[model samples]
Every structure is written in C-alpha cells, then in structure tokens.
Target: MECPVCGEHLGDAGQVLEGLDRRYAPCHACSQARLDPRAPPPEAGQPCACGRRPLDQVMAAVHAVLADGGGLAPGAPLAAVGTPLLHPFPPLRSPPFLPPSSLILLTRYATPSLARRLLAEVPEVRGVVADRGIVPGVGGATHDLLAGCDVYAEARFTPAGPLVLYKQVSTCHIEAPRPRDPKVEATDRAVRRVLPDVFVDACAGVGTLGLAAALRLVPAVVLNDAWGPAAWFAGLNLHANREALLAGEVDLLASYADLRDVPAPAAPEPVAAARADQEILVYRGSLWDLPPLLPVAGLRLAALDPFEKDPDRLRRIARRWQDRAGGEVFIP
Candidate 1:
C-alpha cells in the first residue's frame, strides 16, 4: 500500500502496525525520524507532502481490508450499515475514488481486530467506529481515538466560495455520510436570505453556519459554543481561512467565543478591523455571559441550533437575542 503521508511504498519502506482499533504504516523516513536520537519528534497531525495524514493511511488500510473480505461487490447499491444516525467522517463522504456504489459501516463498539477481519471478509464495506456515540454537544471517550491528532480538516464548496473547516472530533458529531445534506443546504439558503451585518451562531459547531455567512461576506460574525473542542477548532478554522478573510473576498469580522463560563452580561473582546472592514476575535466562556460581549444594538441575525428535544433552550436563546438586538433568529 502507498503511504498516504509521503506517498512512499509502504511495502518497501516499513511495516503496517495493527492497533486495537486502527492500523498505521509509517514510511522509513518518518519511522527513522521518530527513532533518531538527534532529530526532533515528528509533529502530530501534520500532513505529509502528499497532503495525507497517518489517519488517512489507516483508513486506506481499512478500505483494503474490506475489499479483500468480499465486502465490496459489483452492482450493489450504496448503503450505510451500523448504528442508526451515526455517519462516517466528512473525508469519507461521497468518496469518488471508491467504487460507484459503496457500503459504509458505522460502529460504536467494534474491536480493531474484528473490524479488520470482518471488513476484509465482508463484501463491499468501509467503516468507522466512534465508540462513544456520535451525539452532538456531548464530549467524552468517543474522541479518544484522536488523542494525539484531534483536528480534522475538510474542504467544502459553497455558492459563495470554497471553504475549509478545522474541527475537533471530540466535541462535535459528524453529520451526514454524504457530501451534502438537504437540511444543511436549506439552512445555508435560509441564512443567505437574511444575511445580517452582524451574525451570531449561538451553537456554532465547528462554525459551519457562521463560516457560510462569513463566506457570504457578513460584516461581523460571532461564533459561540460552550464546548472547548468546538471553540478551539473554530478558531483554527478561522485562521485557516485568514488569507481569504483578509483579502476582503467576503468583508467579514469573524470571532469565536467559548460560552463555557463567566456571568451574564459578559463582555466579549472587541477586534479591530485590519482593513476598514475585516477583523477576527476568539473568546472562551458561557452563553448568558455574551450580552456585554456582543454588539447587541447592531446584531441583525442569529442562528440557534440546540440538541433535539431542547426546544425550550433554543427558544430561550432566541428570546434573548431577539430582546437584545431584535435580529431575525433561525431555529432547527
């Protein structure tokens, strides 16, 4: 197999190590770099020259295992098999490189050995396991697999422009095994219709909605999330898009504030625009503490997406934003 990181032939450069739930193959260069007494430790999560990570290589091995197991069959329709509601990560979405019709196996608790053996013997299958369950807004062991390398980046194309998001796998859930979901498309359209000068994503999981708004050139966007991982990735994503942001492609002032603590009427740090129109800020604290931190008077739009069955919380948030800025609020 080819090393996803360096594109070196793994069969010739190194050995493939099968772990408890994943497999890894480090090319000789990387392996030696790790063992070399005089060299610095290889950076975690850094992509190789081929723009692939160790995780990507592991997934490739998993794909091979599935193909060898008779899990991949010709003419079979694409299907998702595993816990209902659990989806594969974004990178695996509509993997055009795979067969036209493919199968995805989503498991919450499958041993690595079993996963490999089953996928190799089973026909037409590629799978990923999130042992802690893929529940959004919940953080726990589900992300342990990504300990050393928790960030995942995916590029998405939108009508406004192309966007890249960096997400921490531990906090937010991966939605839709496919590249695009009708609901997300609908939400994007709705947001575009009332694109506000000052947009707030109250529950900005990886800042997807806010990022879309930013791409549309929303003058000011404030992304808030109570989860640390989500907030951390939101900041990283903002930085990843800094070039475009600074270029004024979409006149935007993006800010990420973690609403995990602090009291009500909290003050969010103001970010000075580099140009007359572009600025960025990142904060960490609680939702109730955001009133003082936001431009309540100028706020024009807000999106409140809470967990299913939490309509009351969503309504409360809507009411707050409505009372503060009278901005249009969207709920789902």
Candidate 2:
C-alpha cells in the first residue's frame, strides 16, 4: 500500500495502524490521508489512519463474523493475513448454571495473577465478608470489590462454540451456598442479631436474604418477588427448605406482585399461628411505587433495595415505614 500523504510505500496493515477493524490503514508518518484500495468494495469502508477513501475488507470480515457470531474476542490477536481471531470464555458451572472454571480461565487470561491478588487486596471485599457472612472470594458475591476496581475494555473468549465478547470481572463469584450481597448480608446480620423471630425481607432476589432470614426467623418466613426467575428460584429454594418451612413455619410468596398474595397462618397452635399470623411480607416493584407501603398494617421492618439513586424515593419509603410501624427501614 502507498502512504496517502507522501505516496511512499507502506508496510502491512499492522505497520500502518496498531489495530484493525476495517481494511484501510493509516500512514504512521503523516497520519493524514487514509491508504485505501484503488477499487473500493461495494460495502461501506473502514477509515484508515491516514485520511483517504473508505475501506472494504473491514466490513467484509466484520459481517462474516457477525453473521456467524459476534466476532472474534475483542482483544484476540490477528491472523497472519491480519484477520481478527475471536476468543470466548468457557462456562464456569454446569448443566444449567455457569461454572466457576470460566471465571478462573478469564482471570488467568484477561488478567495476571498479580492483578487478581491486587483485587483481593481491596478492603471492601473482605469488609463485606467480615461485617456480613458474604464471602468475598469466588462463589460469594459479585460487586463487593468492584466498587473501585478498574474496568478494562471488554474482552472475548470462546468457552462455548460461539465466540462471545464480555467484560471480565476482577473478582470471581464467591463459592458459598447462601452467598448474599454485602448490603443484604449486613442487613441479615443486623436483623438476625436483633429481631430474629419475625422480620420481613422485601425484594428478595433468589430468596437469598429471605432464605437466610427464614433460617433465623423460623416457622413462618414470607418470601416475595415478582421477577419470574427470582420467583422460580424462591420456589426452588423454599422447596429445598420444605422440612423447615412446613413445620407450620414457612410462608412462600412466589409470585405475589400485589398485597393479595399474603398467606394465612398454617399452624393452629397459638404460638405457631401467632408466628404465622405475624406475617413478614415481601414484594417487588419500582422505587416510585413505594407509596403503597405506607399503610401496610402489622408491618415490623422492611428492606427496600431500589435501583434508583434518588433521595426522594428513599425518604418516601422510609417515611412510609415510619408511618406504618414507626419502624425503621434499611435501604440498600
């Protein structure tokens, strides 16, 4: 190829630019005109470093890859002919769930062991473990250490047949049976230490908090979520804990979107019925819709983990709980 600027002979595409997305390459010297094919292909052209005409091969390869898959892994090396190579991360888990091995492979390839160690060095991750039972290392929780971790440009690895590009995490999932997010775990610890008899865990994802809360609260634990997956998981988890729940104890709210699904006490015994009647309700909804929670009767404590960043939502939810029971809410 000729340099678009000086008409000087140029090396391969790599010699022109550090990376390749399209066919055209820019001249390292002038960095002006793009060195493009004389007969540009029918497809749209990729810009070269040197400003010239558009490119062809870039789109051809990109289209071919996308039609077949998303493309080679984002950072995989190019072929000898400068064709990009795609990579994918392997599955970490098994039949249904992702295995941990994928994360191990990603950590080894995308990041150095030293970087993983550095990620482990972050105090918040361990603080989550220390404060709550949320194990920080693989199999525990996601995002505990991600607060300040640096995110690189996404990468690609093919653990499965198709090449996929995804952002690799600095930390792996914690390998705990009942791993909880830091905030929920902390709240669980607080509730367990204080009001273990009957506590409500609102917005229970996968019923982790509610499950943990159930183990502690005993006899009657109300689990609620609207997301189909979470609801499904809640049922699965509740079924797994049936022995404890049906001891005239557990109340599962698998699909309750509104207040209608709250269950009646199962046990006839005064203590068991009282425990059952002292229901802990959980639900899933948005932050703005939190107003209805204001009038809920016999409500003790509620935890609302809204995705909103607004203080008004938090204040409103808090005020609602205050009005209902003069109670406290821990918004995570």
Candidate 3:
C-alpha cells in the first residue's frame, strides 16, 4: 500500500513481516538468542542485530549511526540514545522482554526522517519513532511514531482467523503483541468458558481487543474510540484483517464531527463503519454515548483498555459499562 498522505509506497512489509515474525524466546531464554530476518543487512537475509548480540556491538553500531549525523556525545550511556520497541505482533512477549529485535527505536535526537535513515545501520531495526512523551493531546500508553510504518499479521493461531494490521505509525497508539495481549487473552478465556454472541471493545485501539473478538468469530462486535485517529485506524485494521474475520462489505454508516462541532451527544456520534452479523461497528466517541448506537445482541462481553491509570476511575469505568450495557466487562 502507499502513504495516504504522500502516496509514497514506503516501508517494506515483506521484510517487516519476516523480521517481525521472528519471535524471541521468553526472557529467560532470550539472553543468548539471535534473530534472523529475511532482508539483507540493509536491503535484502541478514543476521538480525538484536537478541543476544554483544551489548557493546549493538551500542557501538547505534553510536556510529548517531556519530555519522554528529550527535553522539564522547561517551554517552545507552539511555541517552533511546528506547527500542519490538514488533507489536502476536506471540510477542510483553514489556521488559530483553534484547529487542525487529524493533523501532524511539529517540529524541533527530527528526523522524533522519532517525529512520541513520538507524538503518542495524539490520533488525525497522523504523524510528520519536519520543513525543506524555503531554496534552496525545492518547494511550504509547509515545509517538516518527518515520516508517508498522505492520503485523496473525496466522490463524487464536480463536480468530489469520489477520493483517498496519499503521502509518503515528496515527495509532503504541502497542506490542504479547502472548497475552490485552483483551485478546480475556476474549480467549471468555470464549472457552462460554462463547458470547457479541463483543464490545469500548476503548478499541486500532481494533486489537475488539478485533480479537471478531477473530473468535463473534457474531457481532462494536469497536469505538474517542480519538479520531484511533477510530479511523480501527476501521482500517478491520478491513485489513477482514479475511481473518470472515467479514463482508464494510459500510460507513455515520461519522464523527469535530468534538466541539455540536451539543453533547445523548448517544454515540455516529457509526463510522459497519458489517452486520459478524459486524465490526467502528464508532468515534465515548462508550457512554455509544450504547444507544450499538446493534442488538443476546449475549455480550465488553473489553476496555483505558488510557487513564487511576484505580478508582478504572473501577467506575467497568461498573458503568456493566450497568449501561448489561454485559460481561473485562479489562486486561
């Protein structure tokens, strides 16, 4: 696919997938591992530069790249460089997983474009996302995407079909795939215990959680996000992963206006997109406002991964959803 903004068919998905699918062994076994990618060191088979490579070697390579651009201090420690994030693909272990591979380096030293070019010195590196940090206007548990794109596919491993998800990088929140990604595992357990007819990812971020439900072949799913980019990306992901979802014609029924464009909605803003039956209704607004917009359901389970971290607030969010929707609520 091409860049929606620049029409640049940038970032090699083939290469990205090869490296991304190279899941590392869990932490204990990762200490002395090596990940290999399909692409060569720079362009096309390379011994990936992550997973058990000598720290000095990794750091030295990164240092040289920054030095080429003339930014590395004489002897700056690693922390001064940046953080490395591995592919957000399924089966990918959770945070604190060591020696990341098929990764994107989040930095502050250069523009996203520059960082992308410089970080090419490392074979396993896919892109460079700048650390936008927690400031107003940002959303979710991630930082920001600077350069390149992010892509992932699940090969019919879970209750869902094989699927594909990609992002312009910056438009979606930062999330890595784990053996038990939020809402994914919860959805799995819920399915095993007793399958439900409908599932809702109230705070769907790019449709991960809700889509997990869709993968389980849930008869219907409602994915809503208060953020426009997220809501938009969620729709894109649903389409991209449709084959896995057994989804049909995606229809845009309604859309979101500017937040201040009108009076507070007593219901959801609008239906961004819908595919009835095995429907993935992408809505852009608060879940409280989303209830009246949801399609009918017999059995329902709603999963949420909220941005805010307050414990009390979380309890209220769950309680409120259960009261309003009268379904099983899960936060994972």
Candidate 4:
C-alpha cells in the first residue's frame, strides 16, 4: 500500500501499530490520523503520506473530485434517498482536512436546487464530526443555491495526486450530521449579530459566525481561537477576503495564543468591535479565571462552552454576568 503522507509507493504491506486504533495508521512522517478500509474516500489531515497537506492542495483535489462527481459518471443516476454516505468527524485537534466518512452524499430529488438551499441556510450542519465546513464557493462539498424542490448532497474529498472529492446522493431525509455543534455556533453568532458596534470573537472556530456578523453588523471585527489550527484558519479566511476586511468593508481580524499576549491593535474601534459583538465568552479555563465583566461596562453577554458539561461552571459564569446590567449568561 502507498504511504498516505509522503505519497511514497510502498510494498503491498506496512506494519500495523498494535496499541492504536486499528482504524488509524501512523504515516511514515509519523502522524496518527485515521485510515478506514470501509470508508468512502480520503479527507483532510488523514495522514496523507504525500507530505503535502496545504489547504489549497487539499481543496483543489476536493473540487476536482467533486467536479467529476466522485468517480460516478455524469449521467449516472443519483443515489436515491436512504442511500448511506460517509459521515465525517471534525478535525479540530489535527490538521484541517475533510474526512472520507464525514458525510453521506445523496440526491433524492434529482435536482440540485433544494440541496443547495439546505446547505446554505441550515444554521449548524449536524452530525458532522469534522471541525470545519466548506469554503464559500459554488462547487464544494458545501454549496448555496435554491430551487423549487430540495435535494440532499453528501460528499468527501481525499488526497490522490490531487484532492479527490467523492459524493453520494439520497432522496430520503437522512438527518444531516451536525459537523460543529449548532448551540456553540449560535452562542457565538448571537453575540456578533446583536452587538454591532465593535466586537472580538475570542476562541472563534471556523469563524463563520464572527465573520458573518462582522460583515453585517459591526464596522470592525477581530477573531481568535485558542487552537492554533483554528487561528490559522481565520488568517487564511481573512486573507481570502482581505479585500473587504482591509477596505473597512468587513472588520478587524486578529488571533493569538493568549488574550493577554495579543498585541493591542493600533485602532481601538476594531478592539471595541470584537468586545461588543459577543453574546458569549467561550474559554477552556477554570471558572475562577473567568474575567470580571466589570472592566467592560458595555459588555452584555458571556458564555463558557466546554467540551465537558459542568453545572458549577455555568453558575459561576451566570453570577459573573449578573453583577452587570444587560449581561446574560448561557451554558449549552
């Protein structure tokens, strides 16, 4: 089998590590990403031995494979509803890439319009374990288009010389997987939309909510995620939309390892933009570390979305926000 990371062709065999999940294989480059035989196709950060994990390279292959309809002939009939497709897990801790089994592609209505609409409006795509979503474009695993009937589309992209996108179609309403939890995203978005003056989206994920709210409500916006990968993504996305962000058409963008370490921007409007727009404050720290809202008089909302649910933490957050007027707290 060929090495997934270096793309170096290997003999028919490679030693399987005994202790790790059999579903995962350690690449020659020494990454422990999953490798599934029963899975549909390759995804981002899946230990591509090719040693080429750039976002553009990954998405290029994805677009190509998707353009080709995941090896299915153009005239091939779409998968009927109820057809199973690969469900994906969000790659949060690992490199950002699509997973082969992250989604089950299906085309029930035969038309692409309905599918496009659903993809566009669904608040948070459910069941998707993957951390990120598709880049804004017409022809990706995710897309936006509306027509008379709804259609369901599922796809996965993997590396094979190029990012190869695979897709399946189904008519039946197989519940779409929530790739990123909606409640988490909603908490972030609510802040951005409601508070338009100036905002900072600390711990921003893919930055959808922050970016969107900045585009619509705030004059300036700054986004940061505690994770290095997510911060990198915000940079990439901001670069992709730099024209707007720089022109003051969008908003400010910033990310750092620690909030205290972040260099104060030259302009206070941008910083204020980041601060005022959030309805929630998500952190991976203890409740005691929760910053006092008293410092910011206008700050109205704060939240702490942890991987593990803790009632005491929620109560603490509530008490902190309660001291200030208009401040609301949520733990979901």
Q: Find the candidate with the highest lDDT and give its number.
A: 3
* TM-score of each model, paired residue for residue: 0.56, 0.37, 0.69, 0.32
Stretches off by above 4 angstroms in model 3 are 5-59, 68-70, 86-103, 111-126, 135-163, 168-171, 252-277
Q: Rate the local accuracy (lDDT) of all candidates.
A: 0.46, 0.33, 0.58, 0.32
Model 1 residue 100 CA deviation (Å) reads 20
- Candidate 2 per-residue lDDT, tens place, 1-332, comes to 22112233423212322232232223453223232333222333433334332112332323233223322243332221121111112222211111111111112111233224323432111111111223222232333221222211111111111111112132222222211246545666566555644455555544555555554544335444433333333443443343333333434443323222322223210111113433433444432343344334443555665445599977886787556545556775
Each candidate's number of clashing pairs is 20, 37, 6, 64
Error of 4 at 191 (Å): 4.5
RMSD of each: 13.6, 21.8, 7.2, 19.6
> lDDT per residue, candidate 4, 1-332, as tens digits?
22222233322101111121222222455443443323333433322554323322233233333335433333332221212233222112333332232222332232343334323332111111111233321122332222221222221111100011111121111233333546545655566446634344433443444454444444444454443333433443343333323322223233323322243223221211223333222232223332332235454443444333577865764575455423455553
Q: Candidate 4: where is the Cα deviation over 4 Å?
A: 1-181, 188-200, 220-222, 242-303, 321-326
Q: Model 3, residue 204: what's the lDDT? A: 80
lDDT of 3 by residue, 1-332 (tens): 34443354423323334544444433343334222322112211223334444333354456557655766553555456665555544453332332434455666765655677655556556667666664312533344555554433332244444444554344455554444454566677876565777778898866777776787788878898776656765676676566555567665443323431233345565444556457668877777877776667578888877888788899999999888888688777
lDDT (Cα, 0-100) at 158 in candidate 1: 56
Task: Supply candidate 1's per-residue lDDT for 106.
Answer: 50
